[model samples]
Target: MRFGSIRVRLTAWYLMMLALGLGVFGVGSWFAMRASVFHAIEEELADRIRDVKTFLQDQTPFRSKIDIRDELSEHSVLGLGGDLFQICDEQGGWLYRSSALESGLVPIRLPSQVGDQPVYENLTVRGAPVRFATARVVIEGHPYTIQVAEPLEEFYEALERFGLMLWISVPLLLIGAGLGGYLISRRALKPVDLITTAAESISINNLADRLEVPKTSDELQRLSETLNRMLSRLDISVQKMSQLTADASHELRAPVSLIRTTAELAVHEARTNTEYHGDMMQILAEAERTSRLIDSLLLLARADAGEGGLQHELTDVSTSIREAMEQGWSLAAGKRIELTANLNSNPIVVRGDGEALRRLSFILIENAIKYTPEGGRVHVRLEGSHAVVTIEVTDSGIGIVESDQPHIFDRFWRADKVRSRSIGGAGLGLSIARWIVDQHHGSIEVQSQPGQGSTFTVKIPLAEIPAPLGQP
Candidate 1:
């Protein structure tokens, strides 16, 4: 595996863990084995001391005072094989020394008091490991201290072999674990590599293709699913953006072509005043339409960029609605539609941009009048309660169908394309109105059915009423 790769890191971590576990196991085993070996040696030494005590006690009955050196020499064969033995009096002077300890004195200390428990120690004797035990006994009413020691050469040899085996096996185990772990990690991440390649190959033109979903329920599978979801959303957004661009181009081309053609026709010849005035008027009207369309587009763009500049202040929503109604009367009168308002006399105040609220009301009223046939009726109402204010604009117009109602607020979408085209709208009024309401933390709902009529209701929270002067 390459350095710093996941496979290598996994293998390295596995090896580290294995090494730690093996080291703990080896240390524990070594300590356990040493304890068992020493325990066995201790048992043997205790038994030998007991035998020596029994021999000494037997000799005590035969003689009131026995020679320690001679007695130990006669029964020295009864002691531990290839071991050292010594006897000392209470005064700390050696009474007897066996042949094994005669050549070099293996210093042994007796306990201050006699006890049933024997004292044990480990020492080095003649460059070899040894275990020593000291015990106290009473013989013929005389206190005697006995010292017994055994060589540990074979024990040391076994431990050394164990240590050597552990040293040799641990590295091999670590190497095997590393290789196994690398293989497992590589196998697990193989899907990740495939996902990366597939994702890299996908582009805007082929956003419809999705990554393969893995069957196993794991993080990798979830990642694949999440990425596919993101891709789907991006694809939808891109398609919407493309459609918006095409519609914008088509809409802009009309007014621009009209303006150019009208200007060209007016200057192409010395026309009469009436003709010139009509052409100029037509050009001006198209220019105003183009400008309004551009402004609406820019506003939507700003809203999309999260730069919706809304002023937060106390706004009298009823007044704005009345103003929009007054403006709508002219347009309605031109179309011979009945325009009316049912605004509450009490002020319905909200915290939002007054201009934006007026624009929102205008957009809804204009949309109502534009779609309404001649002699149709349009009504605007503003009502307020303790918590929220409601604005409803009802129109007797070509209502939207159930299927098309959901998309009416989408940019550049129209329920009746041919009628909308003849009606001279850029199909952005409802979208802009929706954005305005959203900025004011409000909701707009549409209730419509084909050939019936439409009611657009807007709800915004009511602002706090100011307090009256206090008598206190």
Candidate 2:
């Protein structure tokens, strides 16, 4: 019932408009009725004057005023009342005066400009309002002015009754209308209230819970559906964040525990300089691994937050692949693997961040070298198609199972956990490579089979070559 509520405001506006319309209609009707009553009274007076003229014409050639008076008295007996009727000749001599006129209750007044048209006027006679009509008529070369009057008390009473009815009924009608309007508004907004209640019941603990979508194809239904969709997205994001937190905790724990254990062992025992140096190297290696994991996590976080920080420029795909191969040569050599590259005679140019592209190539080559056995072959190839440049890194190594290929790019996910851990692989390299490829608007995919090998292919859009300065 608050005044500021939509329901109350709607009802108030409805009532205001209704009141205005009814007021205008009432005033118009009252004026029209009053005019009609006055017109009817005027017509009655004119008709009476016409009747008198007709009667006087029929009784022509009156020899005396007494004869005219006797005829008028006979006319009165015939239901034409003579109390307010009067007549006069051209010389202002009274021909037939009713008793009401002669008794001075109603005065006799001749029109100054007597004409064929009737002259109507309102008069007060005996302290009562009356309507009079006067007209002149010429009969048998004699002119006569006849006047007729009618009282207005009954007409005024009728108007008062109508006015009273309007005054009393209008407010009652408005009250009923206002009540109806308020009820209708409340019924229409009931759905919104239900939605509000349902929405309030949902929280972080119940993110998976969704609002019921109404079947009424209206704004309320749309609102419910949109809110449900938003809830679904929230649910997905929360689940992903929870998974990331658990995985991050598990990954960081191993390296930190190792570093702590190594330091404690070194401190608790006396050791030679050589032993100390070895312990320090082991500690440094664990520390370095932990730092790498943190950096990968931060990079993925920024990527998820839509901050890729890529400085895009034209980069040579062939050159980046060669650089990554050179970086991976030492590892391949240590493993007795044959590292080689197949590059196009001409450089294949693509649009991307040079450093990110180089890192992408390095991750793929390093992953191949790590998984490949000694005496295995690792190959890098850079090729250009009509619209894109493709980098493919192939290796002859312990390949992935079909089931695990789909999740290889997921953070902290490794197909062979023991092998991955033994080789200092945190499994974040492929995930970071995927992010870098996505930032360059490129696509990366892998084809692998157990006991055969793995091939990682990356495709980036070729950069448009600028024409010479004057060319269009």
Candidate 3:
């Protein structure tokens, strides 16, 4: 985070990369250019040697003193940028030198070899670097040393000029690279910068704020879509919490107000034993109802806090349904509702906490029994797919309204508000049941009509089975 803004970091990285690449390119160019300059110099030296050899060969047939001097002076300018040449006798004494030289031929060492042998040397001749080639030969059976040399100052001057030009151009090249890199990074990261600015503008005051993306489908678009999804989830969570807070305040205040007002009424009527006893019964009942509501609220809160850890194992759905029916038999019997099961007694396998599932099954069947009219039927069944077990409970009851069905599993929600609480429920049964199913990675769906009945289906994936016998 201390590395400065995105644009600066991007520009810096681009500049560094471009500088490295260009620096390498410049080094290669410098070396290659220097080699080319040297090659040109070498080619010129070879030409000078060839020209001297030709002149010596032609003058060997008949020696000419003035003619050779004239011919040497004539070609002097064409020789390797004013090359100098001198001829020597067998005794190593200079006979002739190029006219370009101010002084006479100088004494130079000659290699003591019999046949024609070329010797090369670099020396400061006439206050300038020069390459000299010498060859000893016999013309008309007389030994002679033929020497040829060329000035190296022009080549040196060209090299110095190249080095100076490179020195001057390097800074300008780096500056151009830096500028180009900054422009490229800016263009590449413009979309990301736009996304950052847009995100900064969003607020809780405007949860609906969205990224204004162009039609281009790129990584930036994908990033914007992902951020929007997270925002949507946050918005939904906020709405749920707000609604819960309002509903809790409304529900709790009414019961507390009733209790307080009832106690004040009871305080005024303690004159006779009969009046006191009657008032005490009313107070106790209302207090019990309030206590039950608080207990239901606490249970729902525990479930929401994910505290009801499942004691999971493989449990048979048919057996679980039978257990639920037995647990709620008295409640169904009191209402004269016949609780029955359409069960496949086969091993309907499940991998979950048997206790939690049993409790969930009881809650669904209990709801059915409580809501169903007298003599109405509640049926529980165990069904199967290839790799799952399903427990379904259907009942003939005063079914939930379609509008309220969506939120029936929400805590403390009751379709029949006036009737449901009196039936030993603070309306958290479906919520707890749904949470239990979720813990098992199972799902539950409810189908109902206003006057007909309700069907609650629970689906749990099957556990793996060991190798089986043919018909067992």
Q: How many steric overlaps are in each model, in order?
A: 0, 0, 1
Task: Tell me the deviation in Å of residue 113 in model 2.
Answer: 3.7
lDDT of 3 by residue, 1-472 (tens): 2367666687678777777777787777878886786666566655665666677678757767677666766677565225477766777655567764437534565435423656666777667887676776665667767766767798778777877787788778778877776677677777888888999998886777787774458777788888888888877766766776677676667667876877788786555777778767767777786786676566666765667656667777777777888988998888889888888858887788777778889989989998899999999988888787788999999888889889999877887777765664667789888888888888999999978999999888887777678745
RMSD of each: 3.4, 4.6, 4.3
lDDT of each: 0.86, 0.86, 0.75
Task: Tell me how far the alpha carbon of residue 195 in candidate 1 is from the true structure, in angstroms, after superposition.
Answer: 1.6
> Could you give the candidate ranking by TM-score, starting with the highest?
1, 3, 2
Off by over 4 Å in 1: 2-4, 63-82, 89-97, 107-117, 311-314, 401-403, 449-452, 463-472
Best by TM-score: 1
Residues 91-170, candidate 2: write the lDDT tens digits: 77788777666865655555445877778888887778788888888877888888878888788888889999999999
How much is 90 displaced in model 2, in angstroms?
Answer: 5.4
Better of 1 and 2 by lDDT: 2
Pairs clashing in candidate 1? none
Cα deviation of 309 in candidate 3 (Å)? 4.2
lDDT of 3: 0.75
Q: Report the lDDT tens digits of candidate 1 across residue range 281-391.
A: 988888888899999998987887789888999989988888888888899999999998888998878999888999999999999999888999999988898689999
| Worst lDDT 10-window in candidate 3 | 105-114
